[model samples]
Target chain A: MTEAVAIENLSVTFTGGSKPVRAVDGVSLSLGQGEVLALLGESGSGKSVTLRSLLRLHPPKRSRMTGSIRVAGRDVLELSPGELADFRGGVVSMIFQEPMLALDPVYTVGAQITEAIRRHEKISAADARKRALALFERVRIPSPDRRLDAYPHEMSGGMRQRAMIALALACRPSVLLADEPTTALDATVQIQILLLLRELQRELGLSIIFVTHDIGVAVEIADRIAVMYAGRVVESGSVRDVIRGPRHPYTRGLLASRVERAQKGDRLETIPGSPPDLTALPPGCAFAPRCSLAAPQCREIVPPLAEVGPAHTAACIRVAETV
Target chain B: MIIGEPAHLPDGPDRGGPAQPLLSVRDLVKHFPVKGKGLFGKGAVVRAVDGVSFDIRKGETLGVVGESGCGKSTTARLLMHLIKADSGEMVFDGEKVGADLDLTAYRRQVQMVFQDSYASLNPRLTIEESIAYGPQVHGVSAAKARAKAHDLLARVGLEPGRFAGRYPHELSGGQRQRINIARALALEPRLVILDEAVSALDKSVEAQVLNLLQDLKDEFGLTYVFISHDLNVVKFIVDRVMVMYLGKVAEIGEGPAVFGAPRHPYTAALLASMPKMDPDARSAEAPLTGDPPNPINPPSGCRFHTRCALAEPVCSVQEPPLAAMEGLQEAACLMALPGSGHSRAPAPVEAAA
Candidate 1:
């Protein structure tokens, strides 16, 4: 399989503040065509920052970014303004958590989708509108003709999300960047959306980077999962390995903290400390303060993400000692 | 009249009486008027909570699970009397709640904790003062209230010395939530309404707060109306569950039974929709099809027919009453009832290893 997206030594630092905050540390990731990778983390973990960097969504004046990003065999950072605009929706598209906010309320859903298609390809208005209708039907919107004229406010949350996905797919991008697309939706609607995404990915063979804080959501969607903490990828592996038999203490702590794993009336095992401040991180592993298996060596030297098992890597020195 | 839990109702032979429920809501309804299109035009009504009813047993946690605009929060607000119900009866400890009800006595017995930690508490008031303020208004002396607040703060695991004097802005989300819990319990309420109380906290912090709530319930003999969209949390903490769909009760039963063998299509769909924690277990198909019909003009009869996969022609025209299923489970669906030709055998609860 060809590599759809590859990132090497990516770092993002906000220099506008008095103390420069490094949001994304030296992180590296790669996703093959048609593969879904879930960047899982809590707030301030840089999972979102890492995904946003692919599109260069940060303000260049306030943020200093150092990275080599290759998507669809093109270097992302080296793209000119015109090329970047073409690359965004033509080669890659994004969907957000709140589709209503992402969608323009003033215009009809069809108008926005047609505009996206027209922006990427030189087409007549009628042709663009026809393509937009096809995309809407492809995303399973009922009464495609009627829905094309409905504004964002007129549609329900689930319908609005479907419209967003249709808009994202309007340009037929190979890579999709979804940042918590289902986070704000209800559970039933979330499942519907997740299923729709999985179907679209398989049918279209699109490489997707799904960012979420919910581990269960990650398990449902991703083939491989990358656990982020304090701007670093602490663990990277297949979803089954990362969830059932996690080698990293942080990953283990996260799985153990779930209420489903514990019996009623039992005290849930917690990580025992707050997430580290990215601006004032500790010397070694940022998770060391909360890891129950942390030792003197863990606090002194940073543990590189090393292979613990076949196709699984964990950034913990004590991975061997764990079962 | 109290809609008694007939299926799960405890024996009444000993005292010649089944103990009255801690709180009972009968056909409660509340609607807000939408803004008119023109100055002289009449406003439309949004049926936020339409004829909802339930009962909370003493010392029991009744979990209310629903999607957005499903009236879970509105039910909580109604229980706290934060908003007046347009029509229906509420009985608290056998006393009717109404305009003539003693407001102070009612406030002393029921308290609520909101979801947003940063917005819920007063920024100007210190943690201790905020917790003490509720009790002070209910006739407790300021000094006594402060002392009680300090003791309560320690009970919720916040150190009085470290947290009591700090303002709301100084504390983290988890700490502020703990303070909120302390404030809710300051009046020693019998029933505490928690509306998405732990939804804002991180997983670890949420676990800690949930455990704390469990311990506090046992110690204080308190009942909780736990309202949240998270099914997993509700399954872990609540003994019984009530599933609401578009301001109507879809199903209600013991947690294990309700989750294990959901009778209502909506309940089953909700259970199937939860992203399974185990990656190996993936749902075969989308259980539900569409968004819930707009509540402003909800579906003619059954509000869930628009989304339910098993919805028949009759489902959209005739409303199904909440009928008994298996054991203590009750579901409002014609498909699950006998003589509907769709009555399937109930799925048994999986035995834990």
Candidate 2:
């Protein structure tokens, strides 16, 4: 099976601050066709930055990026301006946390979707409109015709999100990049979106990179989970292995701290201390201070991504077994 | 104030009783006028809290869960008297709050902790000053209030020697929230309305804060009106859960009952939609879809009928009352109401299908 997306030792640093902030340290990830990979992290964990880098959506002047990103057999980092434009929506599309901001407020949803279709393909306005309607129907938007005429503000949060998904799917991209698409939605509405995405991915065979802060959301959607802490991928494994038995201390701490795991009246086991500042990370493990089983050597040497089980890798020194 | 009766009554016992709840809200309604559009013609009414009613039993946390614009926050504001209700009755400890009611005394007994500690705390005030300010305003001596503030600071796990003199901005999100909790407790409030108090924190920090909240509740015997959008957090903290949709109660039951076997379709959908951390527990289907209807021109009969998967014709024409369920629970759904006639309908289809 062909790998739909491959990221090799990717790193991103922002130079605008007084001290250059290493937002994303060396990280590598890959997803096969029709696979869903969830990049899980909290605020400032660089999950969003990694996702945006697939389309090179960062400012070029103030920030520096290293390593290679290949999506759909194309070297994303080496694309020309025109090629990059063609690759963005035509090859890989993205939905965002806030649809209101992503959607153009002044235009009707129909015009926006049709415009995206026309920009990438040689199609008449009427044909684009027809395609837009079909896309809306595909995303299961109710009252598709009326919703097409609605503005971003006129539609509710869930409707706007569906419209955003419809817009992203207008180009029929091979890989769908969703950045917390359901974060702003209600639980009932969010599940609807999640299920829709999973169904669409299956039908269309589109690889997906979903970024979110919630572990539960990742477990619900992802085929593989990559737990990001600070700037790096601390743990990468199948969802069952990661959730059932996380090898990394950070992943374990996150699971233990989940409210669902704790019974009533029991104190939640927490990883003490805050996330490290990106501008000046510690010499060794960024999470060592909070890790319960951190050895003295963990402070002097950064642990590599060592395999702990079949198809499982954890960046922790405590793991003793390998596949 | 009634002239024939005494002006004051002794405070009721601090625990649950069959006769009365610590706080009783009946038919609470609040409407905010939509601006500018009204200048041209008739203004729209944002029905924030539309005839919502519930009771907070002593020492029990009553959670209000909902989406944005669902009136959960508005209900908290109404209880705090920060905003006056258009119409309703709030009876606290057998005394109905009215114009003649002692507002100061009522406020002292019922306090609120807000979500944004940054906005709630005065930037200029030190941690100790902010905590002590409430008691000082309530006629406690300055020195005694300061001593109480120090004690509370210690109780919240913030070392007063280091934190009491620091400003709010200097503290982390978790520490600031602890101070907020301590300040609410300083008033010796019997009821604490925590509105999304820990929603902004990270998951680990949220867990720590939740544990602290449980500890404080036990120590202070505080009855909390915990309003949050995060159902998982609500499940862990609150004793009774009240699921709200479009400014109305969809279901009210004990935590496990509401989460496990929800009676209302909306409640069931919300519970089913929750993303379980365990991969093996993947949801079979999306139970329901669509955004809640506009609150200004909410759907008739049942506000949730517009998006409900089990909605029947009667649900669009006749509203369902809060009918009793199997346990000490109630749900406002035509399917759950015995005489609604839709109770015998075929199984509802999944929205995702």
Candidate 3:
């Protein structure tokens, strides 16, 4: 499969007062065509920053990004202002966590979708409208004809999300970046949206970068998983291998912390310490303070991603020695 | 009207001993009128907690689980009397609750833990002051309240020396939530209503709080009305469960029984919808289809009929009453009834390996 999106040695740093805070440390990842990659992490794990940086949406003056990001054979970071604007929605599209905030309340859903389509493609207004309605129907919005006239506020949360997905797919971008797409939705609605995404991915052959804090969501949708901590990918592998037998201590801690997995009468095993503050990270492995398998060496030097098995890698000093 | 010989009800668990329950609620309704008028030219009621009724035992955790707008939070508010119910009967400890009901006395016995830790606590007030507020209001002396607050803080696993003087803004989310729990316990309330208490927390933090709640319940002999949207958490914390849809109870039973063998289609669907943490245990059940019906003009007969997988013609024609099955299970669904064609067989208990 062709690489739909690729990032090499990406690093983002912000200058605050005297010290420079590295929000996203040196990282590298690639998504194949029609593949879904889950960027799993907690709130301030820099998953959002990494995703934003890929599209060149970060604040340029305050934040400095050093990386090579290629999307559909186009160097996203090197694109000129005119080319960036034309290439953004034409080759890659993004869907945020909150659909209502992303959608325009003043305009009808159909009008907004048609406008998105027209921005990327040279089409008549009537043709765009026709295509928009078709897109809405494809996203499984019931009674597309009537829903096209409804505003974002008029639609239910699930319907609004579906409309958002339709809008993102308006130009049929090869790469779709969805950041916490199902977090705001109900459990049932989340399942529906996930299934819809899977269906669309297969039909359109689109590569998706799905980011979420919930590990359950990542397990359900992602073909490959990349666990992020302290702005760096700690582990990366096929979902099956990573989930069944996680090599990283942080990943193991996360899996063990779930209430569902604990024995009926046993207490949940929580990771000892809190996530490290990005502003003042420790000298060595960021997760050393909280890691159960940490030794003196773990706190002295940072570990790079070491191959644990076929197509699986984890950044841990004890991966080979333990288990 | 003739006064009863004794208003106090029997405490024993018998079939039919007394009519008075430890806590009795009848036809509890709370409506928030919408501000703007539509084409109808009149404000509409939000129907937050419409006609909710359930009894709570002296020392039992009654878990309330529902989606965002299913009125779980509103029900908690009504029970706490934080807001007045539009119309209903609320009897606490066999005494009627009303405007004239001694709020200070009631507040001492029935405390609440809110969802948002940031908004619930006063930023200016220190942890000790916040926890002492309830005790002080109920006639405890300032010195006594301070001592009680210190003990409560310790009970929730926070070191009094380090955390008692810290303000709400200075604490982490988990620490703030511990203070919230400590404050709720300051008055030694018999019942504690935790409304989405741990929903906003991280998984590890949530687990810690839940374990703390369980430990406190055992130590203090406390009863909890645990309200939440996450069924897994509810199952972990509660002994008995109450599933709510729209503004009504969909199912009520022992936690294991209800979770292991759900009778109502809504209950089953909710269980199916929950993302299983263990990939091996993923259910083969079909996904729930369609959105929840609008509560403003909910489906006529059954509020869940629009999305229920086993919905029948009768479900849309008439509302099913909450009926008791054999043992300790009760469900508000025609299919769960004994005579109904869709009646499920008794679940076989798994033996210890």
User: What clash pairs does model 2 have?
Assistant: none
Task: Tell me how each candidate scores on DockQ against the true complex.
Answer: 0.66, 0.61, 0.44
Q: What is the DockQ of candidate 2?
A: 0.61
State which docking tier applies to candidate 2: medium
Model 1 quality (TM-score): 0.93
True contacts kept of each: 0.70, 0.75, 0.36
Off by over 4 Å in 1: B1-18, B38-43, B99-101, B336-353
- What is the lDDT, from 0 to 100, of the residue A172 in candidate 2? 88
Second chain of candidate 1: TM-score? Answer: 0.89
Q: What is the lDDT of residue B187 in candidate 3?
A: 70
User: Which portions of model 2 miss their true places by more than 4 Å?
Assistant: A321-323, B1-19, B36-43, B140-144, B335-340, B343-353
Worst 10 residues of 2 chain B by lDDT: B1-10
Using DockQ as the measure, what is the rank order of every candidate, best first?
1, 2, 3
Candidate 3, A1-323: lDDT as tens digits: 89998998899998744777788998899999899999998766889888988778877777899988999888888999899888777788899899999999999999998998888889999999999989988998999999999999999999999999999889888889999998888887888888788888989998999998888888777889999999999999988888888999988888778877764446778886567778889878999999878899999898999899998999998996544
Candidate 1, residues A1-323, lDDT tens digits: the string is: 78999999899999989999999999999999999999999888999999999998999899988979999889998999899999988888999999988999899999999988888899999999999889989999999999999999988999999999999999999999999999888898899899999999999999999999998899999999999999999999999989988999988888888998877678888777678777789999898898889899999988999999888999999998776
Summing lDDT over every window of 10 consecutive residues in candidate 2 chain A, give the lowest-scoring window: A314-323
With candidate 2 superimposed using the best TM-score fit, by how many Å does residue A46's alpha carbon deviate from the native?
1.3
DockQ of 3: 0.44
